[model samples]
Target: MPVIEVDGLVKRYRDVTAVDDVSLHVEQGQIYALLGLNGAGKTTLIRMLLGMITPTAGSVSVLGAAVTAGARSAWARTGYLVEAPVAYPELTVRENLELVRRLRRLPGGTDEVIERLALAPYAERRARTLSLGNLQRLALAKALIHAPDLLILDEPVNGLDPAGVVEIRTLLAGLAHQHGTTVLLSSHLLAEVARLATRIGILHHGRLLAEQHADQLDQHRRRHLHLGTRDDTAAERVLQAHGYHPHPAPGGGLQLTDEHALARPDQVATVLVQAGVPPTRLLTEEEDLEAYFLRIVGADHG
Candidate 1:
């Protein structure tokens, strides 16, 4: 069985469906990320996975055990962080981790985790006094203090600085690749997810719209030729005269998606240069994960 299995999982609130007919599987050592914007039901689906909220329909299984309201078997084997990080405001960072360790009956690993997450500096500092970034690190520390088999995080990089983001990314990657950990996370950070997740699932409007391997993502995103010249108006006309259709890009440039234009951008540049417009910048640019995500979700909404 996969490390995590979500079969036809769904949730609803009155007349509104928060999640709809979503099914997915995560195997050992694979980092699977759910990609969606806020209000896309990513949080609701995650809540169901952890059995924090009962599903309106469908089912969820973790570590080969069915998730139930009272089921605690898989609870000890999983680490998760949903939405904002919380801690006992009166407790020191070390004390908070100790609390988790004692509650979890773990032998010992607090010191290692503190260093691992670069939390050593704040280990003795009270949670209430920690900065937003440090507070987030503490939340992650508690989750990892148990060293559970599966780690589920929502917006894991929230409130983190650039260096902190890189640290967490490296930590997750090392856990998956080296320690055989199965990680399931949700994020709207498209580029970061592209760099990290082994597989990605797109959720929008309470539905799972698409799934693909990260390595194969490039082939799926749209590719276009972008042209920037001294005179965009003349550049657009010149491209059109050369049997190419040009559309205004979001960044005030011309975007051409014709097979000919993409296949031979140099030729298009030649045309633009000869036409007195003179190409300032010309390159074939493929849609990044963010663009692809917006395109897919926008198409669904439209």
Candidate 2:
């Protein structure tokens, strides 16, 4: 059974429809990423899933339990960090986590998560003294203190540096792979999400435009062969004679999107060289997550 499920979920605020008939499911041990631009309703959808807000239509289920406001049973096994991290100004890092533990009725324990999130160095420091990155780490520590089965995070890496980003990425991967924790997160970081998530869902204008496996992302994106030769005219002729449809690249090079040509670039090089117009450069380029995202969004708008 799926770990989290949403069916025909919709959220409306007066005249604006924040979420429009959205539906998705996250399986156990899967890192599901919801990607979107600003005002794409990602946060709204997450709020509904967490039972922070009631959906205008449809329903949400987590761990086989329906999500409703003030429902503590379903939330016991869930951890979340929404928008920005906040902490008591006067409390130390350890004190903050200890307070959360008590509130959750969890047994006495704050050291494990402090070490897990690399917050031990600042354990005695006041929350107000922590940097943005360390503050994020502290929030994550709270989420993980209970060792919850599912995690829902929004912009979890907002204040993290490069190294911190990688650290959290590895941590999340380990959680899903080794501990069978299901994760559902929303972020504008497309490339980062591409690297970490097992499945991806694209949201635009309050609607889910596409959903696909991370491994299959490249398959859905465009790829092309870029070729540069000493003699452009001769190279074009050579390519035409070989029945390859080549188009002019932005920088006066020839480009071909034919799958056969991309797969057999060496053959194209041989053909060009034999024709006395040896290629100066031959390479294959595939669209990255950002470009793929723009293309999809543009196509939808067009």
Specify the highest-TM-score model's number.
2
lDDT of 2: 0.92
In candidate 1, which residue ranges exceed 4 Å CA deviation? Answer: 228-254, 270-281, 299-302
Give lDDT per model, in order.
0.91, 0.92
Question: How do the residues 58-99 of candidate 1 rate in per-residue lDDT, one tens digit apiece?
Answer: 989999999998999998889999999999999999999988
Q: What is the Å distance of residue 261 in model 2 from its true position?
A: 0.7
Q: For every model in order, what is the number of clashing pairs? A: 0, 0
Sequence-dependent TM-score of model 1: 0.89
Worst 10 residues of 2 by lDDT: 293-302
Model 2 residue 193 distance off true place after TM-score fit, in angstroms: 1.5
TM-score of each: 0.89, 0.95
